[model samples]
Target: MPLLCHNGRFADTLDPVLAGDNPSFKWGEGLFETMRMAAGEIPLMHLHWARLQQGLTRLGMNDAALQRSVLENILRELALRNECAAAGRLRLHLYREGAGLGFVAEAAPLAAADHGWNERGWSIEVFADARIAPDAYSSLKRANYLPYLLAARRAADTGVDECFLLNAQGNVCDAARGNVFVVRGGIVQTPPLSEGAIDGVLRRHLMSLLAAAGRPVQELGLTMEDLLEAEELFITNAVKGIRWVARFRQRTYAHAVCKELYGLLGQPFNNALVAP
Candidate 1:
């Protein structure tokens, strides 16, 4: 059986530990971070930890017991116990434990990491049934993920690999599971957080990587027409790094730029078990 870490303790199951009255279970009052583990190390842990702290502060959740070193050790131990220490996807969930605003941290192994980039680009479309609001909560990876869940279900039903969600202003916000990026005329552009895009860890890292390489990304609002007109399109997340898009409606994109960018990301992880 797979083991999970709850409040610094290892357990075979969570049922006996988490109560039904827990705020996270009852009303989705919590935050979560999904991280990639490579060579038994979490490379982007600093970014993930920063985001988690920001989320906790934003939600007014008491973070007195949240320590980066402690959480990191727990995740590393959980990965070892799960037999995915070399490469894996891990998740850290923080939720209200009681009425006094205390929180509990749970670490679970998501899966063994896929080290290879996708050869066939992802196929995606816009989810028009609902528009995500451009609010403070939109940027955080909160436990309540109804919008993305519904969009993902629609994509599955329609035979698409992913679905893009738009902001209330009808601008492209982000994808169902990742942040969207477009390449046009050798310029890379992505929706700004002001446009309601999720503050993705990989997105931030990629932007820094690009800027350091003298190819800074432009943060701006993107429309459906912008995607259709782009030379290439891609989505990014912490685990996947970057996934090129082959088809968005009738438009097909080239993967050349995606390949180069993926290599750029992989350079740092060359010595590690998993690369971008």
Candidate 2:
């Protein structure tokens, strides 16, 4: 099975705008979306597209048709691959240069399953400079991610799974790939959008679900101490879905937040994809 347009149009054969050490690669010129493919189709196609559209516009590269075409092309290609059922990641790369050439890649296998809301957890650390929102513009998930990348790498080196950055005022911001959440007294809380974290689509959906369920949902400022005091803490994204925090620096959380969100999200696939 040849992917839709990947043989002569293959993902492996796809080339980025900069081969050697071009500015974009060197300077982080483009943006990327980490998407999950389940049942051989993107579970939240349009939502991811919406965010990509916003990112393109924020990065001064708006093209609805371009986005759609790249996604359609990749969708076609992925459908042709033999690895659909085994779990995978898709990276849609676009060059900001001339025609905005597209590179759709099918990544190595990922370990993803319905880990149940309350069961999945991750240990995180807080770094001061982990987030570099491309101060040139806003952080549109661009290539310039050395700060966060390096910080996360350091966390891994310290035996932690990931890094959760704090804001200028020492408030817990977000994780490398997902948003952060804290639950105290069974009330769910996350940092406000003004806190300089990427506005995650799935984060919004989860907030709405909690809000509708009458579970406490707060978008207030959260601190490292606030996180430590949380009964349970979790991080979220479209792919990782929801991961609980087992440890952060020297403290360990019981991973109550991980289980709660996971249980909340697993009611159905769309439960994670759509808002309540």
The candidate maximizing lDDT is 1
For residues 1-276, write the lDDT of model 1, one tens digit per residue. 777777777777544767778888889888888887776788788899889888888998876657788778888888888877767778778887653343343334433233566777899988989888988888999888888989999999999999999999899999998999999998999999999999999999999999998999999999889999999999998876788899999898998888888888873232233333
Q: Rate the local accuracy (lDDT) of all candidates.
A: 0.82, 0.64
**Please, what are the lDDT tens digits per residue for candidate 2 over residues 88-205?**
5566655465545444445433343432342335667777754533243443566665666777787878877788876666667678778888888878888876776667767877
Backbone Cα, N, C clashes tallied per candidate: 0, 14
The lDDT of model 1 is 0.82
Itemize residue pairs with steric clashes in candidate 1: none
TM-score of 1: 0.91
Against the true structure, whose TM-score is highest?
Answer: 1
Candidate 2: worst 10 consecutive residues by lDDT?
Answer: 267-276
**Candidate 2: regions farther than 4 A off:** 1-8, 11-23, 65-70, 99-101, 112-120, 129-139, 267-276
> Which residue ranges in model 1 land beyond 4 Å of their true spot?
98-113, 267-276
